[model samples]
Structures are given as structure tokens and as C-alpha cells.
Target: MKKIILSASLAFILFTNLKADAQIKLSDIFKKVTEKQSTTSTTGTPSSLEIGQGIKEALQLGVSAGADRLSAKDGFLGNLAVKILMPPEAQKVEKTLRSIGLNSLCDNVIVSLNRAAEDAAKEAKPIFISAIKQMTLADASNILLGNNDAATSYFKRVTTAQLLQKFSPIVTNSLSKVNASKYYSDLTTQYNRLPLVKPVSTDLTGYVTQKAIDGLFIEVAKEELKIRGNINSRSTTLLQKVFGYADKKKG
Candidate 1:
């Protein structure tokens, strides 16, 4: 009977220890889950206002930087990626002119074209700011979660028509100011005078306007991608918070 009682007490102690161990293990798991939830809740979601401001700030920064860079002297001329080349229809004109040793004229036209584009780029900042101001909360939210070029795509969709309208007059004025129009006319006249060669007529103002807008958009896209992917490019606390959430979502 003593042996039986002893066994029962030992079994009770063993059962108590097992239950305590299980409870401790379960508590550890629960603690970990709670900690994860707390961390996520605190850091994973940005407020709607923050979302809007963050997106706008990012776009503004990108467009402003792009506009500034392109507006500077040699911005377009120096950048092969954004350089405005002669229109496809005028390529023959340039080649023929260069081949015939009218290299200076060709160079003048090229330089003047880039100069016109650079002059027109100065107008992009206000226009971009206007478009950025028009962005809705929903738009900002979608852009925040969208692809790297999402903001640039948004800008293109909303601002292309306005940019074209705004840049046309500016480019036209700049073309005259910079002598691009005259050089182009001279180039075409020289090319057309060559025997057995077809005449080439191009809308110089229209071409420069479109190319300038394209170059600005390209620069903006690069800036957007940089900000989205490079944490070092986040130049503000708001950017860090907004993009930090985006980073976790991607992961």
C-alpha cells in the first residue's frame, strides 16, 4: 500500500511538471506572436494623410530635381540619354550636311536644339507642382503601392497634354531665341539643294517640344525609381516612414 501511494505521489509530481512545461512553451509562443503583432501594428501602416503627403513630396522632389537638371546649361546637350537628336526625317539631312563638311552648321543646329529644350525645361516645375497638387488620396495610395514608375506614369497621364500646351509656345520662343529654327532651315535648304535628293520638311518647334517633355519624364522616372529602391535617397523623415511601410509590404 505504501509503494502504491508513493507511485501515485510521484506520478502527480511528474504530471504537474509536464503541465507546467507545456504552459511555459505555450506562453513563449504567445509572447512571440504578440510581439510580432505589436511591431506590425506600430510600423506597418502609414496614415492616409501621411500617404498623400509622402507621395506628393516624393513626386515633387523628383520632378523638381528633373526640371532643375534639365533646365541647366548643357543638361540636354551633355546627356546622351536625353539628347534631342534630329527627327528621323531629318537624319539624312544631318548626315548629308556632315558628309559635305557642313559640320559647323550641323553642330550649330544640334546645340541650338538642345538649348531650346533646356530653356523650355524651366517651365516644367510649376506645371508639375500643379499636377501634384491635384493628386487625390486614392491616387496617392495607389501610387504608394504601385510600381516604381507609377508616379511618373501618373504624371505623364495627367500632365502630358498640359505640358505639351505649355511647352509649345516656350519651345517656339526658345527656338527663335537660340537660332535653332534658322539653323534647321539652313540645314534643310542645303540638303534640298543637293541634286536628286528629296526635300525634307520637319516641324522643328513641335519636335523639340515633344522631345523636351519626353526627356523630363525620363528624368522623373529615374528619380522615382531611385527614391523607391534606394533608402539613402529618402531625404525626409516622412519618406522614411512611408517607404518603410512599402518595403515591408514588398517583403
Candidate 2:
């Protein structure tokens, strides 16, 4: 009886231990499955969201860097891609005045106009950064999926009016500082002195503002194209991957 009871008790203990071990293994499997499900649920939808965000961040940084590059001392003067040229409307006055032997003054006015544009570009960096920070997921996705210059176009569309308003005063001040006003006045005096010519009048500030904005967009487009076409220009891994996807779509 003692042997029988002892054997029965040993069997019971072994069976209980085996059952406990099996339960632990089952619990571990359930934990792994639950963890995987949670991870999948959390990550699946948000990955696309993150990709869109990353592209926008890349574009914004690219614009800021590009603007900074252009705002330096030789930014406008050095970069042929973005150098400000005289407006066509003002060309007639410049040509007529030069024809009347006031070529030096005409040259001065043209140079001063470009100088004012360069000075006004200094103000654009901060404004552009502000606009960049305001970009949304929808905006990002659109920019990513759109044409090469789409990001720049979106910036121009949203910020051009506000930028114009902000730029006018700065351009006016720059023009005055650069003696553009005096140059314009001298040119106008020479132009009006021309016999049988209509009075040569133009809004120096407004024209400079518009021209400066146009030049900035040109630079932005150049940067955008670089980022799209040149792998080296895409600084970050995310940018490379995202834009690489774009390149594949184009292909």
C-alpha cells in the first residue's frame, strides 16, 4: 500500500509539472502572436504617412538650403541661373536713353535694379521657411506625386501674395539703399529729355519685387530639378527612396 501510494503521488507530481510546462509554452506563443498583431496594426497604416511626411520635410529643407545658398553675398550676382535681368518693359527706356548718349546712367540703373533684387532676396529665406513648416500631409503627397517643379509651384501659389506684400517694402528699402531710386531718376530724366518720347515712368519698387520673386522661383526650380534627377542631391535616405520611387514611376 505504501509503495502504491508513493508511486501514485510521484506520478501526480510529474503530470502537474508537465501540464504547467505546456501552459507556459502556450502562453509564450500567444504573447508572440499578440505582439506581432499589435505591431502590424500600429505600423501598417502609419508607414505611408511617414513616407509622405519625410518627403515634405526633404523638400522644405531643400528649399531652405537653396534659398540660403542664393541669399549669400554672390548668390544673385554669381548664379547665372537666377541672376535678375531687366524687365522687358524697362528695356525700351534703357535703349532709348542709351541711344540719346546717356548710356552710363542707363547702365547704372540696370545694375542698381539687379542689386535691389539681390538685397530683397535676403528677406525671402525666413518667409520661405515659415511656409515650409506649414506644409500638410496632403500637400506633401501632392508635391511628391506631382511634376518636378510641383513643390516650388505649390510654394509660389500659397506664398506668392504674402511674399509680395512682405517683399515690397524690403525691395523699396533695398532700392533706396542701393541708390536704385537715384539711378532710376537719372535715367528717367535722360529719357524724358528725348524729343517726342512719352514720359518714361515705371514703378521701380513693384517691378523689382515681381522680378525678384520670379528669379527666386527660377532658383527653386533648379534645386527641385536637381533633387529629382540627381541622386547625389537627395541628401537623406528617405529622400532618395521616396524620389527613387518617383523616378521608377516616370520610367
Candidate 3:
């Protein structure tokens, strides 16, 4: 009778141990499933607002950087890639002036043109930021996946008309303030006076305005690339999350 009792006790304890182990295994499996679902919900896909906001944020940063760089002294002059040279229509005038002893005058005109551009660049910040504010959800998606300069191109394409309207007047004012008008007038006057040279009447304000816009786009592209490729350049959590999706997709 004692042997029978002992056997029964052993069987009960064994069954309890087995049941506990099975419960533990089931709990671990459930825990793993829950963890996976949480991760998927959090990191699966970026929403439309996230996409639009991220793009706007990136563009705003790019515009700020571009405007700040170009508006400062030496911004246009020092940046060879975006430097304002003599307009194509006025190239002959520059050549003729350089051929003569008017190199000093030509140099002066170049410096003043760049100065005017730099001065006008400050005004571009608000105009560009305003344009960025108007970006649609559709535009944001294309820009996010676009090439290195895609965002810049989008910016230039959409805002150019308005930019021209606003920037032209500012460039006109800047031309006089920076003495670019005077220098260009002097250059052309000297060039026309020389023998066997065609009369040149390039629109100095228009030329500088166009060149400054181009320079801004270039700078913005660079800023965009910096933020896209470099982790450190993404300063905000939104930036991190938005661009993190891009990185995963690219990979």
C-alpha cells in the first residue's frame, strides 16, 4: 500500500513539472509574437504625413543653408562652381576689354556682379521657404525618391516664376547698391569705345538674378545630398525616421 502511494505521488509531481515546462514554452512563444508585431507596427512603413513633412523639413534645411551661404560675402565670389561670370552675350565685351588694358575694369565688374548676387541672395530665403510651405503631398513623394539633385530641380522648377518676379526687382536694387550697374556700364562704355568692337548692352540685373538663382539651386542640391547620405547631417528625430526609411529602401 505504501509503494502504491509513493508511485502515485511520483506520477503527480512528474505531470506537474511537465505542465509547467509546457506553459513556459507557450509563454515564450507568445512573447516573441507580441514583440514582432510591435516592431512591425512601429517600423513597417512611413505614413503620408511623415513623407510630406520629412520632405518639407529637408527642403527647408537646404534652402536655409543655400541662402545663408550665398548671401554672405565671398559666397558667390569664392564658390567657383557657382561663381557669377560675365554673361554669355557679354563675353565678347569681356574678351575685348581683356585684350585691351581694361583688365582692371573687367575685374571690377566681375567682383561687383558677384557682390550684387550675394546681396540679393538674402531675400531668397523667405521666397524659397514660402514655396516649400506650398509643397503638395504628391510633390513630396517624388522629391523624396528623386536623384541627388531631384529636390533642387523640383524647387527650381516650381518656384522659378515667382522667384523671377521677386528676385528681379531685388537684383535691380542690389545692382545699384553694390555698384554692379556702374561697373558694367563702365565696362560696356569702354568696350564700345574701343576700335572694331560691337556695341554691347547686356542686362546686368537680369543676368545676375538668373545666375544667383542657379547658384542657390546648386548649393541646395549639395545640402540635400549631405542630409541624405550622412547620418550626422540629420539633426532631428523626424529627419532620422524619414531618412532612415530612405536608407532601408536604398539598401
Off by over 4 Å in 2: 1-46
Overall local distance difference test of candidate 2: 0.77
TM-score of the candidate numbered 2? 0.76
TM-score for all models, in order of appearance: 0.82, 0.76, 0.79
Per-residue lDDT for 128 in model 2?
Answer: 79
Q: In model 3, what are the clashing residue pairs, if there are any?
A: none
Tens-digit lDDT track of model 2 for 1-251? 99999999999999999999999999999999998875554222234666576666676777777767766776776777666655666678877766768788876776777777777778887787777778777877778778888888987998899879988998899889889899888777876787897886788898889888887888778878888888888776567667776676668
Per-model root-mean-square deviation over C-alphas: 11.7, 7.7, 8.4
lDDT of 1 by residue, 1-251 (tens): 99999999999999999999999999999999998876564355789999999999998998999999999999999999999988899998899889989999999999999999999999999999999999999999999999888898999999999999999999999999988999999999999999999899999989999999999999999999999999999977788889989888877
lDDT of 2 at 185: 85
C-alpha displacement of 212 in model 2, angstroms?
A: 0.6
lDDT of 3 by residue, 1-251 (tens): 99999999999999999999999999999999998876654354688899899889988988898899999999999999999999897888898879868898888889988988898888889988988899999888888777777788888888888878878988898888878898889888887887886788987778888998989888988998898899898877677777888888878
Candidate 3 similarity to native, TM-score: 0.79
Using TM-score, give the best candidate's number: 1
Of the candidates shown, which would achieve the greatest lDDT relative to the real structure? 1
Q: Rank the candidates by lDDT, best first.
A: 1, 3, 2
> Residue pairs in steric clash, candidate 1?
none
